[model samples]
Target: MARLKIADNLDGEPQTAEELAVKTHTNAPLLFRLLRALAGLGLVRADEEKRFHLTPLGRTMRTKGDGAFGDFMEMFLGDQFLPWTKYVDAIRTGKTQFDQLYGVPYYEHLKKNPDERGRFVNGLKQMTKIFNANITDYYDFTPFKHIVDIAGSDGTFLINILKNVPHARGTVFDEEPSIEAAKKNVLDYPNVKDRLDFVAGSFFTDPIPAGGDCYTMKSALDFEDELAIQILKNIRNKMKSGTKFLVIQTVVPDTDEFHIGKLFDQYLFMLTGGKERTKAEAEHVLRGTGFELNRIIPTTYPLWDILEATAV
Candidate 1:
């Protein structure tokens, strides 16, 4: 389905089977057979002249190059697909198969390979838009004077919030690479220039800046549990007793449904050696880290749930 999506642009020009096969690196006959199946499923359509075009479902999958579906598929089919063959071994061993399949851990692989890191970051940017609208709308930023966005990449989410809430100031804290990228993103927002500050350092190693009423981690805690806890504890140590800790993450649904959040959980396991937690699991982690879970606010979108906590 994704291959067909890449083949058919929004202009509705149908690529030949050979062209699609070359693009997807599949055999021509196999690609045509798959397209036939998709046509039967109403995912693709064949005109009277036998040219393939997108059905409504297929069109949705194409997503104008910046869609969440494209990002999701890219991450799924890119580097993460290799570890699924050893998933049973991982389950039996209770260890990540990614390290076994590849020569190194997933994060190590990402750091060593710039191409994979670029793909990962691009996918993250695409996926962030899925929940950004809800994040900007559901949370009340007016009350907070200064917000420190820990591990905030490119400052897209913070910039969106700063634009909406006129009184709120923001500080984007991330690694040097992300901070460099964020500088470019913040150039147009000169009105918020005084309020926006970029700090580049590891949240686990460096001290979180004081004087912020609200501290946020946007999809940042899903990496390593101990590291995540250490970062949270560091922030808690710096913050006042009543400071609000906003964790913007995808809350895993209880059922085994095919939610995007569940798929993202699988990606996390395959790529970062992390797991997306349920609301109960999130509360457990927070409590273990000396934070009191306040509320799990459901966003307007299904992919995200805002878990608000406070230092105990």
Candidate 2:
């Protein structure tokens, strides 16, 4: 599905199986079978000439320029796809097979491989593009003087927020490589540039940067439970008792009807050894870390929930 979607965008038309196979570097026969299956599912349609075209669903996967589609495909298909062979073993051992397959943990693998790191970062940016607007809409930023985005990669989300809230200053804290990218991104906005500071260090080891009235962590808690708590605790320790902490992440719905959260939970579990939490689960985590859940703000869009909490 991903390959066909990308190829359809690249070629600007529905391509035949031969064209798809050559573009995707797969066998033509297998490509034909896959396309046929997709057509049957109404994802794509085949013309009388046997050329395939994207259905409405298929067009949703198409991307413009160097967009989410390519980055998302690279992250899932190229890097994370290999570890699925060991899923049965992972289930048996109750451990991630990614470590066994790559001989390192997921984050470690990303740190060591620049190409993979680039792809992962780009994919994250793509994801942020989808969610940043929702975040800007559903949350209130008027009360904040300065906002610190913890674990903020490339500052894309912060940039969007800062662009809208003129009086609100921004700070982005992340690893050195990501901070460097954020610096480049902030160059255009001189007004926000003076207000924006890019700090490089592990949030676990370093003091959370001060001077921000509000702090945010986007989809960051799911990365590691202990680390996430520690970050919240660290932020709580520095806050003046009124600082607001916003956690923007997918709030897993309790029901089992197919939703993006369900799929993302499995993806996190399989690839990153992380798990998405429900609203109650989030409340538990926040309360355990010396904060109280203010509310779980649902967006007009899907798969995103804003958990607003404050230090006790």
Q: RMSD to native for every prediction?
A: 3.1, 3.0
**Residues 1-312, candidate 2, lDDT per residue (tens digit)?**
654454454345777888777777788888889889978987788999889887666554554443335456656766788888888887888777788888888888988899888878876776667678556687879778899999888888888788779888888999999999999988887767877888887776687888788899887568668767877777777677778888888888798777788778877877878888988888888899888899888876565678888878
Q: Assess candidate 1 and give its lDDT.
A: 0.76
Model 2 accuracy (lDDT, Cα): 0.78
Candidate 2, RMSD to the unseen true structure: 3.0
Per-residue C-alpha lDDT of model 1 across residues 157-197, encoded as one tens digit per residue: 88888888789899999888889999998888887767799
Candidate 2's C-alpha runs over 4 A off are: 1-5, 8-38, 41-43, 63-68, 188-191, 254-259
Model 2: lowest-lDDT 10 consecutive positions: 59-68
Candidate 1 TM-score, C-alpha based:
0.85
- Top candidate (lDDT): 2
lDDT of each: 0.76, 0.78
